[model samples]
Target chain A: MSLNATLIAQLIVFLILVWFTMKFIWPPIMRAMDERAKRIADGLEAADRARKELADADTHAAEEIKKARAEAAVIIERANQQAGQIVDKARADAMLEAAKQKAQAQADIDNMAHRARAELRGQVATLAVQGAGKILGREVDAATHKALLDQLVEGI
Target chain B: MTTEAPSSSSYILHHLTYLQLDLRTWKIVENSQNFWVVNIDSIFFSVLLGLVFIGLFWPMARRATHGVPARWQNFVEVCTEFVDGQVKDAFHQKSKFVAPMALLVFFWVLFMNIMDLLPVDSLPTAAEAMGIGHLRVLPSSDPNITLSMSLTVFFLCFWYSFHCKGLKLVAREAFFHPFGKWLLPVNFVLKVVEELSKPLSLGLRLFGNMYAGEVIFILLAAMTLHYSAPAHLAPLTGTAFFIFSALALVTVGLVAYGKGPWMRAWLPLLILPAVIAAGSIFGFLPAIGGGAYFQILFATGWGIFHWLIIGLQAYIFMVLTVAYLSMAAEHH
Candidate 1:
C-alpha cells in the first residue's frame, strides 16, 4: 500500500517509544532485580555458614572439655596411688624400728637383773659370814654355807 | 399517518443519509451550503458495539490468570495469538513495541468490522429518542477515522525507518536506491510520494469498501414504502429476498478472497465481509424514510451489531501500524 504522512509519523513515534523503553528503562530494572537476587542469595549463604560454624565450635569446645576432664581424672588417680605407696612404706619401716627397740629393751633388763643377783648373793654371803663368826664357826662357813644352802635348795 | 407507506427506495435513502459536519476555513461551519455530507446508519451502532466489546474485554484486563483461562480470556488469547502470528510472519524484527501494537490494532479493527452484523434498528431507536441526528458507528466507514488510523500507522513506519536507518540512511535510500546517483532528485521525490501514499491508500481502501456496502444496503432498504404510506403497498417480500441474496453473496465473496491457511482464511475473507454487509443492510439500512418508531428500532439494532466492527477496525489499524513499524525498522 501507499505510504502517508500521518502513518509515517505514527510509526516514528511508536518506534522511538519502544527503543527508549528497551534501552533505558528495561535494562536498569532487570539489573536491579539481578543485583537484589544476588544479594539475597549471598545473605542466605552467609547465614547458613554462620550456623554451621557455631555448631562446629560448640562441638569442638565440648570435646576439648571432655579430654581435659579425663586427663585431670588420670592425674588425680596417679597422685592417690603415689601417696598410698609412700604411706605403706612408712608404716613398714616404723613397724621394723619398733620391733628392734622392744628387743634391745628386753636385753638390757635381763643384763641388769643378772648383775643385781650376783651383788645380792655376795652381800648375803658376807652378812652370813659375819653372823657365823659371831656365832663360833662362821669363818670357814662362807664356802660351807654356800655349799649347804645349795644342798638344802637341792633337797627341797 | 399510515394511509400510505413509504416506498422501499425512500426507506433506504433515509437510512443511508447523514447530518454531516462541513469545514470552512479550518473551522466547522454549521449549515454550510452545498457541502457534500452524509451519515452511514451502521456507524452509530458500530461505535456502541465497540463500547460493548470494550466492556466485555475490559474485565479480562483486570484479573488475568496464568492457569486455566476463562472463555473470555481464551477468546482474547486467541485474538492476541492470531495477531502476534501475523506480526511475526509479516514483519521480521525484534521490535520491542511493534508486536503488541499490532495485536491491539488487529483486535480493534476486527471488532469494528464485526459491528455491521447487528440488527439495523437497535441504536437508531435510542438515538432518535435523544434527538441525535445521523450517528454512524463504523469508524472504518468514516473517511476521517480510517484516514486518521492509517496515517498513524504510516507515521510509525517512517519513525522506525528514521530511528533505525537514521536520516542519512533514509535520505540515501530515497535518493540512491534502485537507481544511480544521477537520478537522485527524481528518485527522492518519487520515494516521498510513495511514502506519502501509504495511509491515503489504506484509509481509502477500507472506507470505500464499507461505504459502498452501506450504500447498497441503503438502496435495498429504500425500495420499501414510506412509513407515512399504507404498509400493505410496500414490497417487503421482494426487499427481504434481495437483502438475503445480497448478504449471501457478500459472505461467499469474502471467504473466497483471502490466501491463508484453510480454517482462518475463511474468517477474514468470509465472516468479516458478511458481518460488514449484514451490519450495513440490517442494522443501518432500514432507518431512512422511517417513522419515529421504525427509526428507533433501526438505530438500536445497528448499534448492537456495530460494536463488533468498531473493535475489529481499531485492532486492525493498530496491527497495521505495528507491522509497518516493524517492517520499516528492519528493511531500512
Candidate 2:
C-alpha cells in the first residue's frame, strides 16, 4: 500500500486511539495510584501520631502515679508530724498539770505541818503559863502578861 | 507467482502488492491508481487493530484498581507503566496527553508489527478461500502507515514547539541557531534539515525495517516454494540480503548524520547483517535438506528473532517519538 487515503484513515485511527486512551484510560488509573499513595502516607502519619500520643499518655500516666504517691507520702508525713506534735503537747500539758498538782500538794503539806507546829507551840506556851499559875496558885491571861510574870516566863 | 513455476521475484512481488481500491472507480484496483486510491488492507487492519486495542485496554482501565491486580489488569498495568515510563523518561513537560499517546503508539504499532511474524500464507490463503483477492496484514510494512503515524507525530511536534517556544522564539531558533544574526540563511537551512529529518527518519526507519523484513520473508518463502537447486538459491537469497543491507546502510547513514541519539542508528548495523546472513544460509540449507525441515528451522528461528524485532521497533518508535516531542516541547 502506498500513501493515499489510508494515511487519513490511519491518522483518524491514531487520533481516536490517543483520544480514547487519554480520556478513559490514563486518568483513573493514575488517580487511583495517587490516592493509594496518599492514603498510605496518611495512614502512616496517623500511626506515628498515635504512637507518639500513646507514649505521651504513658509517660503522663506514670508521672501522675508518681505525683500521687509523692503527695500521699507528703500527706502521711504531715499527718505523722501533726500526730507527734499533738502527742507532745498533750504530754507536756499533762506533765505541767502534774507538777502544779505536786507543788500545790507540797505547799498544802507545808502549811498543814507549820499550822500543827504553831498549834503545838501555842499549846506548850499555854500549858507553861497554866503550870506557872498553878504553881503560884493563879490563872494567867496570855493576852495581858505583866512585866515580872513575862520575865519569869522567859526564864522558865 | 506465475503460470507454471512460481518465479521467486514474482512471488515476492505478488506478496508485496497490497489490495487497493480506487474510490473514483469504486472498483478493486490492483495497481495504476491516478486518483483516490486506498490500501484497503492497511485501512482495515489499522482500524481493526485500533479496535482491538480499545477493546483490550478500555475495560482494564475502566476497572483498574490501586490494590492487587487481576491477570489481564496486570498486563494492562504493565503496558501502561511501560509507556508511561518511556514518556516520563523522555518528555518532561506536564502535558496530560503524552503518556497515553505514547501508550497508543506503542500498543498499536506493536500489534501491527506482530502480524508480520505470523505464517505469511495463513491469512492470505484464508482470505483467498473466502473469495478475497489479497490481504497484506502488516500495516507497519506499509510506508503509508508508518509515514502517516509519523505525520501525526510531526504535527504534534510542530504544535508543541510553538506551544513551548512561542512563535517568535521558534522563528528565532530556526534563524539564529549555532550562528548569530549574520548567518540566518545557513542556520535556517540547518534547522530545517534537522527538524525535517526527525519525522522522516522516524517514519522511514520503521517502514524500512518492516518492509525489508516482509520482503525477506517473501523471498525466503519463494526460495523454498520454487528453487530446488542449491545454485538457484544463493544469488536470489544474496540479492534479498543486499537489499536489506542497502536499506540498513541508508538508514544508518541518516541516523549517523542525524543529531539525536547517535547510538540508535548503529543498532541496525548489528541486527540486519546477522539476520540477512542467517536467512541466506538457511535458504541454502533447505536445498540440501529438502525444504520442510530447514524451512521449519528457518521460520521458527526468524520468527522468534522477528518477534524481538517487532517489540524493539515498537519500543524504539515510541521512545524516539517521545524524545522528539521532548525536544520540541523544551522551553526556548
Candidate 3:
C-alpha cells in the first residue's frame, strides 16, 4: 500500500470524530448513569428505613396491647372486690334489722302478759269477797273486810 | 456469472484496487505514484461510517435518562458502558478525552470491518454501475486508513506523556530509565524503536488482518470464474458432491455424540452452504447454476469467521490505544 495524502485526510477525520464524541457524546451519558446509581442507592436506603420503622411500630403496638390487657385485668379485679363488699354489707344490715325486730316483739309479749295478770288477780279478789259474805249469812263490817281483801289479793 | 467473464487474477486485482483521486492531475486515476493521491473510496466509506456512528449515538446521548431506558437507548448505553469500563480498567486517571476516543475508535473500526462481510462485489458492482472504476468498501483494509487512526492515537499518547511527565522527566526517562544514561545512544535508539512500534503494530496489525481477510474473500469470489467453464464443471460438481457427503457424515457423528445445542445450531450453518452448492452442482437448483455455488459455500464460511476478526480487531485496537495512553500517563 502506498503512503499518500489520504493518511492525512483520515487523520483529520479521526481527530474530528474524537472531538465530536468528547464534546457531544460522553458527558450526558455518564451523568445519567451516575444519577441512576444515586437514585437506586436512595431507593434502597428509603426501603431500609421503612422496614425499620415498620418493625418499631410492630413492637409499640404489642406494648400497647400488653398495657391495655393489664389495665382491663386490674379493673375487673377492683369490680369483683367492690361487688363482694356491697354483698357483705347488705347481709349484715338485714341480720341487724331482724334481731332488733325480734327483741321488740319479745318486749311487747312481756308487757301484754303483765297487764292480763293484773286483771285476773282483781277478778279473783271480788269472787272471794262475795263467797265470805255468803258464809257469814249477814252484812259484815266494811273496814275489816277491806284489810282481808287486800291479803287475799296478795296471796292470789 | 457474466457472458464474458474476467480472468481470476484480473478480477482479484480489480477488487483490491482503490478508487483513488490524483491530487496532482486533479482527476480520478487508475493507479498513481503521486504522493498527493487520495483513496477516495476508503475515505468516503470511513467518513460515512464515522457519521453513522455519531448519528446513531448522538440522539441517545442527547436524551439519556437516569430512569429506565428505551431499547435502542439501552443498546447505546451498553456500548458506552462497555467502552467506559475498558478505559477505566486501563487508564486509572480520569480523562475526558480517552474514553470517547476509545468509543470512536472501536465503533468506527467495527463499522469499517463489517463492510467486508457485504458480498464482496455487491457495493463495488453497484459503484461500478455509477461510473466508478474501482471501489474497496472496507476502510480498515487500507493501510492509509488504519495508519491514520493509529497515528492519531499515538499523538494522544505523546500529548499525555509530555503533559503528565513534563519535558525534563520524559526526556530523561526516555534516554535513561529503560537502560541508563551510560549507554545514552543505545537507550535513545531503543526508546525510539519502542515508542514507534506502538503505533506501527497497532496500525499494521489491523491492516494485515483485514487485508488478508479481504484477499481471501476475493479469492473465493474468483473461484466462481475459475469453475464456471464447462471444461471445469465435472471436477466442480464432483468436489461439491464429495463435500456434501463428508458434511453429512460429520452431522451424523455430531448427532451420535449427544447432540449438543451448539452442535445443533452451528451444524446447519455449516451444512446449508454445502447443500446449496451440491444442489446447484447437480442441477437440482438450476437458478444459481454452475460453480457460483462454490463461491457461496466458501464465502459464507469465511464471512462467518471474518465476523470474529472484525469485532476482535476493533476491540484490540481500542484496548491497545487505551493501554498505551495509560502507560504514557502513569507516573514513574
Candidate 4:
C-alpha cells in the first residue's frame, strides 16, 4: 500500500484516543488502586494491634490466676494452724477436769474415815465403864468423859 | 456456492485488495496510484475496534472501586496494570501521556490484529452483497495504519527529546558525541539514518508479519475454490485422508489425555504414527480435488498459531515505542 491521507487521519484518531484515555480513564482507576492499597495496609495494621492486645490480655489473665492460687494456699495453711490450736486447748481442759474430780473424791473419803474412828473410840470407853461398874456394883459419870473423847477423836 | 467459481489466484487477489476511496474525487478507488486515496476499510475497522476498546474500558473505569472489584473491573484493571508495568519498565521518567498512549497502542493494535482470525472470506462476502467490491478486515496488515502509528511514536520521541534534553543538547549530540566533532558530518548522517530507521522498522515489522499471515490464510481459503472440479480419484483419496487424519487425532488425544508410565514410554513411539499420518495426507493431497477438508485443517492450525502472533506484535509495537521515547529522552 502507498502512503496516503489515511495516515494523517489515523494519527489524528490515535491522538484523540490517547487524550481521551488520559483524561477520563487513567486517573480514576489509579486513584482506586492507591486507595485500595492504603485500606489493605490499614486493615493489616489493625489486625496486628488486635493480636498484640490479645496476647497481653492472655498474660494478664494467667498472672491473676496464679495470684489467686497463692492466696488460696495461704488461707488453707492458716486454717490448718488454727485447727491444731483448738484441738490442743480441748485436750488440756479435759485433763484439768479429770484432776479436779479426783481431788473431790479423795476429800470425801478422808471425812468418812475420821467420823468412823471417833464413834469406835466412844464405844470402847462405854464398855470400859460398864465393866468397872459391874466390878464395883455402881454407874460412873459419862458426861464428864465427853471432852476426853472429843480430844481423842481429834488426835486420831 | 456460486455456479461459476472464481479461480484460486483471483480469490487470493480479491482477499488482498482493500476498499479504498479517493478523497479528491469522492469515489471508490481501484488500481490507482493516487496519493490522495485513503483505505476506507482499514479506517472503518480500526476506528470500530478503537471504539470497542473505549466502550469496554470506559464503564469499568467509572465503576472502579477501593473495595473488591467485579470480574469485568478486575479484567480492565489487569490490562491497565500490565500496560502500566510495561511503561514503567521501559520509560523511567514519569509522564501522564506515556502509559495511556501505550494502552491505546497496545489494545488498538491488538484488536486490529485479531481481525485476521475471522474466517478470511466471511466479512468480504457479506460486504460484497452490500455492493462493496473489496474489503480487507485486518488493519495492521495495511502499511498505512501501521506506519501512521509508528509515525505518531516518532513525533512523540521528538517531542520528549526536545522537552527533556532541549534542542541544544540534542543537536550537539547529533553532531558531536558518537564520533566527536572531527567526524561531525559522518556522525550527523549516521544519526539521521539511525533516527529514521526506528519508525520504518517499527511500522514494517508489524505490517510484514500481519501481511504474511493474512496471505497464508487467503491461500488456505483458496484451496477450497475447486470444489466443483472433477477428479478421477477423489473418493479414494478423500477416504484415505479421512482415515489417516482420524488416526492422527487419536494419537494426539491419547498423548494429551492418557496417563501412566506406559504412556510416557510410548511417547517416542507415538511420533511414528503421526509422521506416517502426515505423510499419507500430503501424499493423497493431489488426488483429493478441492481438498476442502485439508484447507479447514490448515486454516484451523494457522488460526490458532496466529493468536500468539497477534498479541505478540501488539506488545512488541507498544514496548518499542516506549523504548524509543525513553532513548530519545536520554541526555546522551
Best by DockQ: 3
How high is the lDDT of residue B68 in model 2? 67
Residue-level lDDT tens digits of model 1 in B1-332: 11255556544544544444333344322233443322223334334444444444444544445445555456655665576677777777676666655544454456556544433333433354345544454455556556656776777788779988889888788899767699988888888888777777777767776666565434433433354323332234224434554565455444433234653364655565665555444433343344534544554565455454455445555655655676678644
TM-scores, each model vs. reference: 0.48, 0.67, 0.81, 0.78
TM score of chain A per candidate: 0.67, 0.63, 0.71, 0.64
Docking class of 4: medium
The digit string of per-residue lDDT tens for model 4 on A1-156 reads 678888988888889998999988888888888898899999999999999999999999999999999999999999999888888988988888888888888877877776777676657667766766798898876577667655654565
List DockQ for all candidates: 0.02, 0.41, 0.59, 0.53
Between candidates 2 and 4, the one scoring higher on DockQ is 4
Better of 2 and 3 by lDDT: 3
Per-residue lDDT of B241-328 in model 2, one digit per residue for the tens?
4455456556544543344444454555676567545544533232444664555677778888888889889999999989989999
lDDT string, candidate 2, A1-156, tens digits: 446777777888888888988999888777666676788899899999999999999999999999999999999999999999999999999999999999999999999998987676556667767887899887777667656455554553
lDDT of 4 by residue, B1-332 (tens): 22246788777878878888999889997856787888899999999999878877887788889899865677888998999999999989878988888898899999999989766755664455346888899999999899999999999998899999888999998999788999999999999999999999999999999999999998887777765333333344444444554565466555533567555447638674665545344332333354657776898799899999999999999999999999998776
Candidate 3 regions exceeding 4 Å error are A104-156, B1-3, B226-287
Task: Please report how far candidate 4 places residue B249 from its true position, in Å.
Answer: 31
The TM-score obtained for chain B of candidate 1 when compared with the true chain B: 0.64
Write one digit per residue (lDDT tens) for candidate 1, span A87-152.
999999999899999889988888898787766665665665676688885365566677865544
Q: List the residue pairs that clash in candidate 4.
A: none
The C-alpha RMSD in Å for every predicted model, in order, reads 15.0, 12.8, 9.1, 9.6
Q: What share of the true interface contacts does each candidate keep?
A: 0.03, 0.75, 0.85, 0.75
For A124-144, candidate 3 gives per-residue lDDT tens digits of 666776777789886655566
Better of 1 and 4 by DockQ: 4
